[model samples]
Target chain A: MSAVKQFIPLFDRILVSRAVAAAKTKGGIMLPESSQKKLNEGVVVSCGPGAVDADGDVIPVSVSVGDKVLLPEYGGTKLNLDDEEYLLIRDSEILGKFVKVTSE
Target chain B: MSAVKQFIPLFDRILVSRAVAAAKTKGGIMLPESSQKKLNEGVVVSCGPGAVDADGDVIPVSVSVGDKVLLPEYGGTKLNLDDEEYLLIRDSEILGKFVKVTSE
Candidate 1:
């Protein structure tokens, strides 16, 4: 079974996989894996449909799958699946998303 | 000026006044002021129009003015208005409402 199908988040919850440190920078600067600084970032692995409002309306989540997002230092429930660690957090708890800058 | 008119909570927020200790119980038992037990209770003073949903619909608050409610041990923004202390909290933060029981 696929990892995504193993468990599904509910009610505006999101499953995120923390970003791993890269050995090289985007500018081609080489750095040792141990020397690479870990950032509070993650990619949206899966997300719930959204939370229901008092009027029974579905409030869609702002982030989508494969989106890179910035996470808080704390909060979110940690989960272990297939020996990999992930975080399940509410959509509202997410700080923001990282938008790619394209220079024309 | 009336206390209620002084400040109006907005967006599902409620203004509450903590219940004061009474010298006597509802069962007519007499108790000294110092011996009276304080409870995690409050009376709703004012409520906001309600929070707006994604569709711009207003979700009415569950508790109304003069409604007795159970409060959490902590939370709610404290305010001192005209020498009186009050708590401003979201309606969702309230644990539950105390309904008056009537005997036929």
Candidate 2:
């Protein structure tokens, strides 16, 4: 019933929604969109069944849906649906998971 | 005893040696080094123990040493040792395995 459920990833693949553009400077000065370096941050939307082993067994991936992860600058297939863009990256392409730090 | 044994990759990392430059035209005219586009082909020298799970079990990688593979155009840690340069890429960065085809 949701756009997120429209597609299913396969073979250790992960669907991610990219975060908003960076480059919010200290002052009110706004630089052109092309001049700013894009960050590799995103939130996982969906995941595949995981990679297969030598014996044909599926090994589960480390990250899951809703997990915020750091993506590589390059690679990953681009997907466009319903006027929205998404990225399909492999499980190994995920640099690291971003965990929120709450005030203790 | 070989230079390949000098470094051992960790996690899903893989050590690769880039293939030679392309652009050797059929006419045998040599193009300048700067004009040639580099292919993402390489031989796997070594690989890490593979990714771990929540329970901390090591999942064996799909590829092995001595396999010819397609490398990504970017996002690899470069390593230079004893004159030869190598790359440290993740297992997922490998596009696919390259197999030689012979005339039957």
Clashes of each: 0, 0
Q: Give the alpha carbon lDDT tens digit for every residue of B1-104 in model 2.
A: 65554788999899998887756676888878886755567789999998876667787766789987766567899899778989899886665554444443
Lowest summed lDDT across 10 adjacent residues in model 2 chain B is found at B95-104
Candidate 2, CAPRI quality class derived from DockQ: incorrect
State the displacement of the C-alpha of residue B79, model 1, in Å, after optimal TM-score superposition.
31
Each candidate's DockQ score against the native complex? 0.02, 0.02
CAPRI verdict on model 1? Answer: incorrect
Model 2 steric clash pairs: none
lDDT of 1 by residue, A1-104 (tens): 65554677898899999987788887989988787755667899999988888678787776799988766567899999889999898886665565544443
Report lDDT (CA) for all predictions. 0.79, 0.78
Candidate 2 segments whose C-alpha is farther than 4 A from its true place:
A1-104, B1-5, B101-104
Which one wins on TM-score? 2
